[model samples]
Target: MYKPQLNMESLERCVKSLEENENNVRDEAQKALLNICRNVLRSPNDDKTREVRLDDEVVVEKLLPAIGAMECLFDVGYVEDGERLFLPGNVSLSRLQSLSKLLSAVSESKPVTKDIEENSTAQKAFFKKISKDFHNVMHYEDPDLQKKARSVIPIAQLEIAAMTKMRHLQKSYKFSDARKTTSSTQFETELTAKDLLLVELLHWFKHEFFEWVNSPKCSRCSTECVYESVVPSTNHRCSRIELHRCEKCNIIVEFPRYSHPEPLLTLRRGRCGEWANVFTLLCRSLGYDARFIYDETDHVWTEIWSASSKKWIHLDPCENVIDKPLMYEKGWKKKLTYVIAYSKDEVQDVTWRYTQDQEAIMKRRKICTEESLIQFLRSLTDQRQNSSNYSSARKNYVIMRSLLELADMLYIPNLQNKNSNEIYEGRTSGSLAWRLARGEIVQADIEKNYIWDVSKYGKMFELRYNIVKDIYHVVHNDGTILEQKSGWQEGTNITNGGIFRKVENDWKMVYLTRSPQAQYGCIKWIFEIANSELYLETFKLRTKSEVFHGARVSWKIEAIFSDDKVIVIPVSNCNNFYTEDVRKAVKLNIIVTLSGGQGQTAWQHAQVFRQSLENIEEASMIINIQLKNH
Candidate 1:
């Protein structure tokens, strides 16, 4: 005769209490025992009665022996009788699974059962209650969840969209996988630029931005410690603190579990909460509209908006995963009931996106009614949208569009029947063409022509002397032209020129050649007497302005001579002279001087002068000096 030592009703009640309880210690113990039972019964055999018998035998013979293995694996205690197992109110999922595996390995014998159908009803009801409680626990809402979500989502979006350091990161970490993967073969045949950018950003956030916190050494002995316990935080700065006991010296240390993202950024270390929070912030810093996803099963991650694909892509910073929503339920074998995502403009129930067993998930969602949940989310969304600075029509349109998107996700027939492109057009104009029309979100402004007031810097005018075959021509901005014999003669004067000034938005030339001392004869050299002080001042101002506007400015001097000869050179100084000695040494050598902001000055001489400026009939030859900003 076999009698159960553990009352199934008591265990079932404990599992049910797990859903309503807030105490961490009691909940952990219940979760551990329930997980062990789930793993033990999760065998491939479908014989319900045989499984029940095997489960009982396993609990008595194999499971009790496996408790020793769990004791070694984790800092937890357990008590067991013939059929019931009691835990020391502290257990982690990892150690639970480890114990369950050990039990399964030891209890390999098949159980014989004759009354399979008779026991099926009771077994089903017991398991059903356990499943319901487990689901309720998974969806249990944290008081601060909504607040954290709101703080993180919009900022994450801004971070990823505006990130300028991406190119450097891309060079170091190639996004080969991003370019290869398509969102869906049926709809999105190719990866768009936004898609690729999102993937790259995920990689950057995971590999470059965040790092895990290593366990601290023992304070007394300086030896590595094993994590032992956790105390839930009473205040807002942190969520909890973990206890680590040294293996060598029996010394205990406390490790604070942080919840804030700002401090975590500087500390650069933490578990999933810190990782997700900081990652969300980084995503927003780059200007990619993002959402902070809160998994009810004690995890968090990010989701970013893809304008090109017109969807939100899942990104797990800790796992370096992108667009794999089913990883939690399918890969991790997690039974999730709620996956809420929060953004600045909306609160969404995104659970369906991550889970495969929607029916089971819905059954466990007993905390709130569907209508109430929808109303709460809608109210939150409305509060956010109404608080925004957007115009009425734009706000309505955005809200309507968002609701349609939510409908599409929920498979509400009306909106889901329409193409995604149509929904996008409802928010924008017709078609998804507006995103393409907007162009790149973060592009550098192209440099354009800038007008510099010469009066503010130096003299607004200059003079030039050119020699054509048997022609000595001197030109000035004052509309004065002087011609002398081609050869230098005795008593010849060569000081005549013109001075130009900018007045009333026009260049007014004053003739200096009217005086006898300003007259010149047969001189074939160019001389410039610029104000060095003004040149330096103007250069500094120009460079400073360019830098302030995120640009660079450069100066060049070009000299045109008679007989269609032209010489161009770079300028870098306040005083420059084109002497005849150098001109003869290097035929057509022209001196160019430039002085501008930030102590930048350049002087260059160009020897090539094949192009001639003699085709012009005007007496004064034009010397074009160009200032370019880049």
Candidate 2:
């Protein structure tokens, strides 16, 4: 349970110390730790690996002196010990991932780099003029991007193995009834079957198909490795190769960091770059009009045109997130400069969709003037559109969509307790230290307690007070048992010996009984209005029983609108009926409280009348209401 933090500085020191050793002690230690990590990863459910004897020869000789290796082992849930290191429970998948990251860190030679490539002739020339850093933003303009994307379609389509995986992704959730609303945005049209497929694809790609490589395993010894240097690659598809030395065997291993998705289909590894590349290609293979989205702050993702929403929707295969445009800026605290999206037929500067801090982003855009950048984007877009042969009507629709998106970007809303997509936390896929190094960690605020949050129906209620714990019963005047408890708590049943007493002539009675120890008991019921134009004509409350022993009854009615506005009406000892016109009520709350009551509180039937604006048809709004005593 007590997991120690992996200290990279200590690990670096240990690596250096081991390298300076006169014998093969360092190799033996590195091999021992690597074996432990590999075994746990390979068969996490094996009970044999749940504990390690601290007195074992290898642990005492090879691991104890290797402080860094021991630290990593402790970090990955091997710290529990009573003279023996014992894993407390089933190995956590996250802890296993953390172990992999630790193995990569000591062997890594350089920081993680972006997968960069020149897009077009103009883009290549432009990068030559501007700083090389800006090329990440401009690489989306590659005219042959679609051709490259289409290349991988046959891999997933023609191959029986790949098709089996794709078929697995198509199996949808049984309860997947499509809705027009998401957490953040509501669409004009309901989600189509295609949208659901894309959602399923994201899940399958992240969990099943892809594996993130922090550091490639050594081909010779399959143990820990150290990065040596870059070398020439014989393959034309791969532009460069990285060499890593097996810490155990001292054999050189070649890692060809390929950007091409074709080979990536077989390799199925790398960081965010490979993820986005293969995922985008897969999207194209599936006939979804997908875009390769490039973030100037060194991230890559995908976007697809949604036929239902009639706009581009953001999808991050690496994070398994969809339509969370603000994740990079708000969640990851990334200082974004330019977020450009490129598809076969178009290229656009979509940075506005991702961040609200345009002023700061513009200030950071120092590699090229804003005007020149705009000109370059426009020139590239124009070239694509002119060649694509889009009709006049199609062009107008595209322009209109862009304007709508721009307007949406400029419009700021009061997000407090409103925005459904609460992307206020950091990245989830990477290791803790890796996330920390990337400045992607965000401290979360205190969690909130919600009374009701059925966001799918666009309804939510915030309760400030903890409800009274006592239970109560609602019965008819003749004691025919309108409603009663069903064994939720001990002694919840009402007194069974007596029937309700008859009320005054021509008046029926409904009563509520409070718990004996409770000072104040209340019952509240919620009513959902079916139509917007319905209005409450009158609310009548009459006491059937005369007051006795300083007992009192009070009632409150709350009409909550769709905009979260609430109107409250409270009345006490209402011997006479009252008429109040409640209009356009989306939800209605009725609460009746009996305070300082020793006996049951009887009412001569509370009646609520509703009338439609179109037709004056009166109806009782309350039906089958329940009462709970304090």
Candidate 3:
């Protein structure tokens, strides 16, 4: 009799080694096991049934020991009855999920016995049931979407590569810090210079490549024309052309409504649809991840992925607006029904991002059942995944990650429980920044006077002020009296008098003041008076400060006062003054410190104030200031 020696400890060592060195060592170990099974052992009986039984016994006795030995080394607990192994903490969540699913699948495949024929029948039935359920949920029948998705595949690859290179190039340029707070700030933050290369390309295409097609001009007389009637497309290849007649020349002009992006690239202009289609295609061409965001209120835009931020930022090529998500709803005051974002890999209902009142917006959603919409999106996602060149595992990972991201966006907390009327009123109230920009003087009635304890940017400060004989007796939050000079009119002196006006049921005190030198500029202070408490919402200042090289410096300062106080802390020996060509430039270096009430420092920034004494003149600069309490 010949017997095979099974070294469980040696098998365990080899299995543990596979974790560190998987390829070569694992292959060798597998081969050695196979060779041992084939050459070392022999069947005891000559009967085929007995030989098969002996083979099964040999496999179970030899291989099962190795598996059991691995349990100790891997720290995995195995249950014999259920054939379930408790995975170690080191295993990933996805890996654990996959293993659990595999175990369930294997159990279902062999419900009664481990017979191969029965297992195969069970597997087929399971798959058939899954296929039926999938079809029932995903009943979308849009061939055009499928065709478009397939067409963009090659375009996406090339564009992604180009955008990657552009991002690298953009890293080399330095932008000014002053531009960070402007309207373009959101765009700049979302898309840096590197990101804007793609935007610039799109902008160029919009201006040079695309033409704005309105009414056609008369060919004979070169006169402006109006559309007389629409001539429908005769075939699929040709678009519907409009028959236009020139009012001045009495000449007819034919205008083709080019709907496709491929032809529109050459034909050049249609409307919002044509522009969005071509722009989206162009974005895809640069390898940039993009989506066509269709607003049901007859508008369309594109959103490109910002790799740096890991988010899709809004980009409107037609308006040259980037990352202005609130432009339509807040800026344009458009009531949106639905804002569906469609990408090659997925579809998302992103209406919440745009609309302030979700309840009002939901009332207008009458297109399809939510269930059917989800099914359509799932179908599109499936088609895209099928068309994707990535492996099954990679595609599945991407799909899962995307769904998680969408879920996160959909469940964000709604802080403002504002109704339709409140939303409208809030918008009309015009923020501190808006009123300051317009340099508007607003007045309100002061109901009563009381000292207000305020904090600006976490720095504690108390305002002591009262209205006496229609004149505001104002004092600084630090108990310092503001300078009220001779020949100063009430409400016109920045440090002294102010007028109040009613705004949104709150009294707004509009105070005017000038800098230490009127040549520097004038500052307007608007304080909101509510509950006998004064709240500084905002301040606007227009100042002409002297800089170096005889260059006059003009500054427009709009400061929004919050709960946190802005404290100017002077720094010793940091100030540097230099003269260039007899023009002195004073650079006042100080640390802008911010602290909370608990005596803890919140934030600090080093600020350098530069001024030139070359063209020192009374600039008549107007600064409007407004304050907001939150």
Candidate 4:
């Protein structure tokens, strides 16, 4: 297990800095962010509401320019998707709503009160306890642990140059067999050319480049060896040595479990750890950005960044597996928690990418609080991104790649490639008993036992209330009898709906007839802002001073279902009425369930449009919205 080696105080400082950036752009950024978050919290299941157009002038000018704002967004689960920012459905809506409330207060210039200060202090203490718990784990404080963890890639990079000199490996019979039998046709057809090349390399590496060593064979007698006792290793490459005895020859054999990749290149025989280490080095030697993924449950693998695919693809050299992220969890039924991927330029928590049961995994995550764990991981990544060893271009590339991987972990669906022959076969490299004892063998009907909660996975989202403060009641009043209404269709049944459009510096209302098959009418007002930021300062039905006829107006927020059905959102105070932002649009659709010359109509309705807004005597609403340069 890779324990987090981080200073809790430094982490606290980092978080405070992330939150305390006082850049002037922070205000507008938070306002824009608040709107975006409100929409997501309102209609979490609605995919359109979760996207932030990255290319839009508003996002480019207001959100992206503010680093603090972008950090806040990322913290709340917004990730990049090409030209847009997406909040994945896997994110907890309740958590997001809470964070948004804090952000809203920040945007409105509300000072943190004493209670809030006390709460923050308690949160810091909790995080400190988490950090302390991490240190309590055995070997967590071992100076060599973190050093070895960070040194894997740099050492692997150096091995790339030494690989050419490994004459013993080149001369081996296994190498010849691998070279002779290598075939690209065995791989999936959908693989890009670059991916195909990696597949070929993996095929060669698994079959010939490396060998799994359960126990050392007798050098004097060609016989299988049995594990004896552990012994200290004199070799610098291995921290510990295993003593084995030949069954037939009664001879002792020494098996050193090498930690470094240099000796593995020549020896070519070890367990998953050595195989992963060497294979990852080979990948880097071939000019691919590769990572060593360490699963806390005692397994190791390699992840290669495919430029063609633009994402990290899982590879298990020991099993000759390609892209079977869920095989361990689903096929072998391993209870996984932490699976961290480390490279020269990044450190990522990739546990989400491999599990089908996140709820279960989350329960098993007892090592630290999620917030502290994420902050620890981010701190590691920030160090790499701003490393003095990297060039400006390289730093930028690392930053971009980190963002891309973040998006993949949060947003991309982990649909394993079906073409992998061994996806469900489970451990093939080790002996049958070893596989069974380690619970690496795929059991009959094991996968069937793990049923995924659709609502908790994929593109699903939780239905939540809108963050709006209040919903003003619609009041009606009687007015003078209508003479002739402009833009009213005489033959049309105009009692149902009306469209509000800005025309010639004044807003015009066009009466729309309710479809004969429809139940009620809707009064819709759409405000579209192109390449600019928009904010709803106020949306209220103002009271009128004049006396008039009265009509009953019931205001109900409605949501469009996937089946195109309009279902009333049963929330009080207009908090259920979520504003939709689609392609730089803010639409307000008010559905009027009842209308007409029923004795219930009024004159004061002119202040706030009546149920029958089509009546020429009715007044319009004062929509106070601000659309300005981002």
The candidate that achieves the highest lDDT relative to the unseen native structure? 2
Cα deviation of 29, candidate 2, in Å: 37
* Ranking of all candidate structures by their TM-score, best first: 2, 4, 1, 3
How does candidate 4 fare on TM-score?
A: 0.41
Query: Would you estimate the TM-scores of all the predictions?
Result: 0.39, 0.44, 0.38, 0.41
Model 1 segments more than 4 A misplaced: 1-14, 17-194, 213-224, 232-235, 388-394, 410-630
Give the candidate number with the greatest TM-score: 2
* Consecutive 10-residue window with the lowest summed lDDT within model 2: 497-506
lDDT of each: 0.42, 0.53, 0.41, 0.51
Residue 411's lDDT within candidate 3 is 49
User: Tens-digit lDDT track for model 3 on 83-113?
Assistant: 1112222222332222233333333553222
Q: Report each candidate's C-alpha RMSD, comma-separated, in the order given.
A: 28.4, 22.5, 30.1, 28.1
Reference-based lDDT, residue 540, model 1: 13
> By TM-score, how accurate is candidate 3?
0.38
Ranking by lDDT: 2, 4, 1, 3
lDDT at 235, model 4: 78
Could you tell me how far off, in angstroms, the CA of residue 623 lies in candidate 2 after the best superposition? 53
- 1-630: candidate 2 lDDT, tens digit per residue: 122334333233334433433346656776787677677667777756665655355565576544244545665556422224555453355665645554455456433222222343334444443332233323333446546545534343334444454444334422244332332123214545567668767877898888876556667655545445555577866756766667667788777877566678778887787899788877876677777887855688999888777677889998899988888888887777778776655567788888767776775554445666777777766665565456767667667866766665655333322574675667866543335334465322222221221121222211111002222233343434433332112211122111111211112222333322234544455555443334333444442323346666556768677789999977554444353534455556655555553332222122111112222222112122211111
Better of 2 and 3 by lDDT: 2
